[model samples]
Target: MKKRVKQPTADVPALDDDGPFAGDRQFVGALYRGLEILRCFRPTDGPLGNQELSQRCGLPKPTVSRLTYTLSKLGYLVYLEDSGKYRIGVPVLGLGYACLGGLRIRDTAQPYMDELARHAGSGVLVGLGGRDDLSMIYVACARASSVVSLQLDVGSRISLARSSMGRAYLAGADEAERTSLLQQIRAKVGEEHWPRHEEEILRAIEQVRTRGFCTNIGEWQTEVNSVAVPLRTPRHEMPALAFNCGGPAYLLSRERLEQDLGPRLAEMARKIQTFGST
Candidate 1:
């Protein structure tokens, strides 16, 4: 057998390359690096050491150490003596809660989402879309039955390749932005597992574009099913936000989610958008 070394593809870039932001002066490298470090701490993650953070962020170990120390001192991150590692501190939660508190959409969407969730016996969520790897974050979530959905709320992150909310977002994005995000997803998930997801993601986005909504049937999680629609806010922010309705797979099967609940979600999205404009 012959040995082969796979080279990096131009489409999938290294973390340090800066890619599109190469010479954008207003883009502060240091601040971006710090935020990147903060984002590395997922709600599911345990305390992480500097070495792990360095590898995850693709930054030098020394830089990660300094950044971690600074974050710790600022109360944005905290060190654990037993673990000899750091975890997200209370201040980060304050920041996320603060942002959610001021969001006009969150306030506007809650009542409707609660009503919808009650009727559908499912979960309804509003997600903010972004170009970043964890592409969407839950801003408002309403669950009628805790037993029917996972415990996710404001600040919960979801992958762009798997969630119905993410597909709706991608369907609403411009071509260049979509391509860039797909490339980032490929780089993050790696080549071996990207193809299967890539095919399904494209198909779902196409469906979203044609039908004005999207669906996920046991894609992100085998026990989950969901449908979503993009909301065009007055601001028209890039990678505009999405609204989703989802629940336990047994209760929110593909047929039910796509056929019955999907249009309801899409309607809710429109109403929310209208509210945002007003």
Candidate 2:
């Protein structure tokens, strides 16, 4: 039987002691909630109604309805008049591409991703994590085989606590930043599910810090395995890019991952960083 996927709770708390409205209460809440609603549409074709969105987000129907209407007015969402549904609009696409154009790491990482995919017969991805947050944004992706059903794609965002790509970025972050992010993740996810194995997680981070690469097996998704390394720019001391390769679990067992793929991914990160410099 397939393992049950853990669902996020409805009333997850804010990341700090100051509560949800710590900074710019009303405006920030609206902006955050609106973005959350938008993020829920990914990995699927969605033009969800108010009820569907409310259920998905565990937010009130009235709140979702208001947010949807407001987003539609702001040109971030489009209402299908005949179908009575809503979809992400042109503005979001425009802004997404605009953001992509500004990231130096994405440009440098794509060629390496292509090379990795070609050589390994697996999918490669590059992700950028928020400076003050633990979430990762998948910036670029290259795939070799169409048979694999990896849920991630370019422009996707994932929680740091649940993904190896995100954890790799976290591992490379400075001590203060890493601690703050871990605290934030714990607050958002609650203590029970936030740290799967505290000792193991810390040991992995330490190993990544030493070897400059990370590996995982069935951490994010059951029967999916991956390895990642941090990419640093010449000007910065810390990582600006996170590169990963993912494939079926059986093909990427723990022993082979540590013995073979780990070094290969680290080498790819170094090459990508060099390319970024020139």
Q: Which candidate number has the best TM-score?
A: 1
Displacement of the residue 2 alpha carbon in candidate 1, Å: 46
Q: Cα deviation of 83 in candidate 1 (Å)?
A: 3.6
User: How would you encode candidate 1's per-residue C-alpha lDDT over 228-256 as one tens digit per residue?
Assistant: 88777667532267788776777777887
TM-score versus the correct structure, for each prediction: 0.84, 0.78
Which sections of candidate 1 miss by over 4 Å?
A: 1-20, 122-132, 236-239
**lDDT (C-alpha) at residue 198 in model 2:** 54
lDDT of each: 0.75, 0.69
Q: Give lDDT tens digits, candidate 2, residues 176-238.
A: 977877777777777787556455457668768887777878887889887776666776533
Best by lDDT: 1
